[model samples]
Target: MKNKNVFNYLKQLHADNAEYKEQMAELKKLPHEYQVVYKEIQNFLWEFTSGDGMDMLQPMYGLLDFFKEGAGNQVPVLDLVGEDVGEFAETMLHEIQAKTRINELKRKMNERVKKEINQNK
Candidate 1:
């Protein structure tokens, strides 16, 4: 039963991956302006994954949403791309928030420790 479940999961995963690749190929077939945006996104991803910076997130997400809305429901490829960009931006925002909270906690802890040390002296 366990093996059957694992096989089913793997099959679904493979199917989903194939669908994603097909969608991307279709996106590549878009007209010049759309293709330009797609290429820019590709370049952005390469830079992003290569550790360029988080500053590009906002602008990229904006551009993605703009294109997606412009294409509307007629273009599933654009919608998917926009959704992906939004997800990425959300993830980055969460990470930044988490780091900020951690820093605040650390600062409070350090302040408390310093006060305790000063009192001892």
Candidate 2:
């Protein structure tokens, strides 16, 4: 059972990793300025990774999406994130952290409900 669990975990990880790579490839194709700023924001957010650090990924993807939209519109990178990029990163971090907390609460609630249903059966 343990081996099965580990295999499943690894399988899911390998599958999901491809998507991350794709996002990175898209980032690479972006304008040099956007690439530089995205990497900077990515590094800044990484410093605050919680536990397994998976939560940081969502914000990064969001940032990439944001950059992609801006690039599509031909907006300057500075205009996209403002002159203070650090401030922009902090705002994203705050939003993701808040979202993480809310997700945890929802997960706990669902687990409790699941437990109750299991017990009733």
Candidate 3:
């Protein structure tokens, strides 16, 4: 059973790698500005990566597609990302909900407050 689980994991990992390569190839076809912005956003978000970070890939894939369509219509990268980049990245992190450190801290703080209130009651 343990071996089977390992095999399954390896299979999924290989498939994911292949998909990532394909995504990268597609990304390369985009304009330089788009590529630079994409890499910047990717690096920023990676710092906040939670767990294995597999949850983050789906959003990135979507972001790439959105960028592609916008680029196709001649939309500037800055326009797609807005004037504020960091805020945009934070917003994306919130939407991902991958049990980040900030989220964990918030959860802990709430629990502590709840416990305190109950004890006082």
Candidate 4:
């Protein structure tokens, strides 16, 4: 479906009961690492359903936050690939820093332009 992100893909799957079941069956054939994530999500859903509906979302949200922060790949890649991965991570950090600086500069420039326009008006 035309380059949808993971959330949209998941929404589509959830919308179709038959397709969702079919995908669940297919998930068993995935690699162990991938299967583990699926299992964890299923466990979360089970808990989310069985519990009082409050606090059950924390673990699921925590898992999403872990990935959002790139913590999942950081240590494992370093452990598996050693020093080279460290250099790659360092490069990534520098790139992120550069992007942040560039964005800040753009924001400041835009604000100055807006202020000047307002003063002229």
lDDT of each: 0.56, 0.85, 0.87, 0.47
lDDT for each residue of candidate 2 in 8-104, tens digit (9 for 90 to 100): 9999788778878999999999999999999999888777764555677767888899999999999999998999999998888777764454466
Which of the numbered candidates is closest to the native, going by highest TM-score? 3
Q: For residues 1-121, what per-residue lDDT tens digits would candidate 1 score against the true structure?
A: 9999999989976876685566556655555566665555646443434223334434444545555565554565445455575464455444434333345567789999999999999
Count backbone clashes in candidate 4. 0
lDDT (0-100) at residue 75 of candidate 1?
64
- Model 3 residue runs over 4 Å out of place are 104-121
Model 1 bad stretches (over 4 Å) = 42-121
Against the hidden true structure, what lDDT does model 3 obtain?
A: 0.87
Give the candidate number with the greatest lDDT.
3
lDDT of 3 by residue, 39-117 (tens): 8888877777766767678888988999999999999988988988888888888887776666667888999999999
Could you give candidate 4's per-residue lDDT for residues 1-121 as a string of tens digits? 4656877877755656564455556555444544455355545344323323323333434434443344344544233324464354344334333233345567789999999999999
Clashes of each: 0, 0, 0, 0
What's the best-to-worst order under TM-score?
A: 3, 2, 1, 4
Model 2 poorest ten-residue lDDT run:
97-106
lDDT of 1 at 67: 56
Which should have the higher TM-score, number 2 or number 3? 3
Looking at candidate 4, the ten consecutive residues that score lowest on lDDT are: 47-56
